[model samples]
Target: MTGALAVAEKVPEPLSKAKTNIVFATIVLGMLLAALDQTIVSTALPTIVADLGEAGRMAWVVTAYLLAEAVATALAGKLGDLFGRKLIFQLSALIFIVGSMIAGLANGMTLLIIARGIQGFGAGGLMVTAMALIADTIPLRQRGKYQGALGAVFGVTTVIGPTLGGLFTDHASWRWCFYVNVPVAVIMIAMAARTIPRMRAVVKPIIDYAGIGLVAAGVSCLILGLEWGGQEYPWGSPMIIGLFAAAVVLLATFVAVELQAREPMLPMGLFRSRVFTVCSILSFIVGFAMLGSMTYLPAYLQYVNGVSATVSGVRTLPLVVGLFVTSIISGQVVGQTGRYKYFPIVGTLVMALGLYLMSTMGRTTSVWLESLYMLVLGLGLGLTMQVLTIVVQNTVPYAQLGTATSGVAFFRTVGSAFGTAIFGTLYTDQIGPNLTDALMQVRVVSPEVAANPQSLRALPTEVSAPIIDAYADSIDHVFLWVVPVALAGFVVAWFLKEVPLRDSARAGATDVGEGFSMPEPSDRLVYLERAVSDTMRKARAEGPVAPRILADAGSDLSRGEAWALGQVYLHTRIRGAATLDAIAEVHKLPDEVIEPIYDRVIGRGFLTEDAGGLRLTDTGRAEVDRIRASWQRWLGARLDDWDCSDPADRALLDQALANIAAKILDEQAREQEVAHV
Candidate 1:
């Protein structure tokens, strides 16, 4: 174990604080652009269709992007591992810029749809790689705060996207929606090139092209079937039936391929854990409810209530407000209690109740009443969204962290695609017949005026009443149909087993360095108390402990201090010399900064100056052994808790734990080594 730790210590030092921040900022910018674009084009869709004269194919504008994004997300993470994250991220940004430019200048609907698909492909790569970069650059202890901030970014973009789209569509050309992405993409690309680090996977990467192709084909077929059934073709028609059958066969084949592949894109082994399975399902439901509802609600507000695009966007603020408030509160509460299962259960129930309430809305339903319903739904979504991802991260082995994280996201995206398609089908199925009946009753409305929702506003109140009612009823039915889906999610939430969240990065401490040598449990206890104190302070400010506070409880040792001690122990045991200058050089800290820490350790009698260099005392040797034992126990307990039965996995966990313990020590050592300088 000591020999391995010594060899591992030879790796290059981490980036400086300034460089890390720059890289993180670049990642967030890319993520924001990708996330923002997901919904930004929605409000402009009606105007886009009107200008292009393709009302019947308008849904394709969104569907093409979604399908391409789903495929891109599933494959991008592996690509990042095989090549490098910085290169993949840069390529993604460049593709997005090109796609945005093409979409902005597109002369017809077909060209626009193709452009959106291209944009979606790029966006998918950006989203996945942005997340992986954080895991790469940030320390495990600080990850929760940054991850929380990223989640906030998603929420902000989701709320503001429609309003931004509406503003551009109403005041300028709808082309501005795509055009707006160009500048953001250009800036992100510049930052990434300058700051993003080149990180390669430790193990040789094997591309799972067969698995990728099968899954992509399967998802595309399924989405097409859902999108076209009952609208473009009868649900029972051979075309729809064949698509459905093909989806099933393709998906089944994908599962078979993944089971045999060396490095499967999806990694079917993760499903062995109950937590991963449950979280994936819950994530799917959340996406289904969220996008499905978001897609149609604006139409309801505009067509049924006779509002402009801007007003419709403004009216959805109640839901956004509800989402923001609950998300913060839930995070804070979970940080304090470390209890997560309840939030999803309560969230799904509230979501179902909200949907049921929405189903009861009629033409006479007041705006305030509708707003209240939206608030309930938003609150439900907020509570569930943040927690589900945390649980998945908690359960998976650290080595598979990126894959697990992306897997949850992949399921959510797939859910969004299916939700939008199924909801569109339900809305179309109801609205067509309802409109026919409404026109028959209101004879004063001309067929041409009735066909266009924008013209409905000019009609007399008597002529528009039935038409408005028809729109209300169709939307109501859509909500009613979704209630069962939310309810099913509610039931599933009850089955989610709450595992204690670990604070250390999932990849384990070995990746960071080796465990620091400590004299006794009492000495370790002092550091543990400090870690707890620091965590409490951070939690009070940031919200709940969530996953951030797990193994990382506030410790007395700073990251640099830990690193210094670990380096000293490793050098004394194996490489002979343990001078302040040598430690400083290895860690990229100045000798002046590390001098004080060496003085402190010598003062404590852990080291003594000799002709060879600073050497560990007899006490120091015993302390190093204790630290190793402590880390082994800690790692063993975690593996047992996870119910890892495989002997190979247990061995990996042991090595990883040793590395993680060393890392914790290295982090503290480095902190002190650089503190004075």
Candidate 2:
């Protein structure tokens, strides 16, 4: 045991600052590949349709990818936990590269759609695993900065996707859009192989294939119904009706299965927390508005404003700028203040206002006015986007951290799919009749030209004016319908309870290593209380007890001195001086290192040096009591609603809580001993 402790102490910590930055950069690259792919093909769709001669089926390209991505995201995190994150991450990147290559070489619309589905599947895995890896690697206190920067990447890629697609379609081939992911994915795969740590579930792995199948089928059916209704099939048609019915039945089955599964993919228990439920709903709404708006805005600009595809992409910059700036600022503020509830509330309200403004836009609305509306919408999404994930991470137990994080992401992707589908339905329903009527009055445009929006700019002014007005009116109505969605999100944000963020270094130590261990809830509570105390002290500018004070007190204690003091105080009260010597000897540390820490405590009046060796003064005893109280309060907050009606279970919890407090003191003593050496 002594030799093992000595060797463990000698091992350096796994993640240094430079390594963290490198892994973070690799994560961001993987995330960008996924995020950018979501929108990059939008500008190339027309070219693809023209070449493939399938004008009516163009929407399927986007829909297929989204559907597949949503399913992949829903399962990726659990697979990572079961298998191992590094292996899954690498596999996901490789899949993405293969899918991208297949897409680039696709010659038919059907083949392209299949390729896109493959790409989406790979992209989905990349996104969820990348996010889970971040939680695994980075400490929570500093995660916001990296997460915020990732949000910026999403914004930049979203804004530029269309422009880049347009440039490639015009100057090069439309295939480049898919080809673009290959090199970036390759680079990500390389970095991940070298930098990402191996982490796997400590518990025995169980495959929840039934739960996975039910949920995937349920979500797939739901999206398919939404996509085909009012476009390919009537709302009352049997196909749509059957799809919706299957969705409900399958989803219910999934819930039932989760209750019994040894390791369910998405644990239903997490939804018991009000914070998790509210943030999830908010995430859904944000995805709805953000993606729905992005889908239609460019079409509105090109058809109504008579702009080229590239020009339309460039004009949407204000929205991206607003989103990028606010996301970073919000993340930074939350990191510093540890207050997050306000941002989402204000964000949703602003989003509703922006959608309302967009609803009011008409055929004659100036470009500047439209840009201003987009900026407002972007700002609202920015504030809401990154914060919800951060909140989910903060509240969930480390055991469910990956599952919870991916669950929130899965909702957002599902929301985006539904939003785009419904928005398309509304636009097509409104535009079909209006365009037909306008063409009858002015025969300048052929039915072919009217069917293909890409050719709308080629029509003369007299013929295109009515068509433009029809498009503007249809898009305005789509925006009007979404106002309610954003408003619902705003109301839900009000119910989000603000929980204090946990310190990553203390609470997340287990998260970083190879073997997973589920610490008892009471053990976690003890660590949580100590972390909270450290945060409070730092916030009050009273942290990192001065080295000079240690020197003045004739002790060579390090920053870990408080922990050592607490240990000495605990040992003297319980098992006597023999326990202290045992601890030092077992850890293979000299007695002098342990002795000075107590000497410092004695000098500070928290302890007294006497013939008995050492004893806690009144102040020291009071401090220990305070630590106990803090742990009790933290545990109470977490377990308030937990069922404890059985006396045996309740007693077990009580004993565990008391044991954890002592365990914390012992662990700190060991760490301090190493630091002093």
Alpha-carbon TM-score of each model against the true structure: 0.80, 0.72
Worst 10 residues of 2 by lDDT: 514-523
Instruction: Give each prediction's root-mean-square deviation over alpha carbons.
Output: 7.8, 9.0
lDDT per residue as tens, model 1, 198-313? 66655445677898899989988998888788888998999999999999999999999999997677789899988899899998898888877877787788778877777777
lDDT, residue 477, candidate 1: 96
Model 2 quality (TM-score): 0.72
lDDT by residue (tens digit), candidate 2, 72-156: 7756655775677678888988888888998899988889888888888888888777766665676434554555455456556
Best by lDDT: 1
Whole-model lDDT values for every prediction:
0.71, 0.69
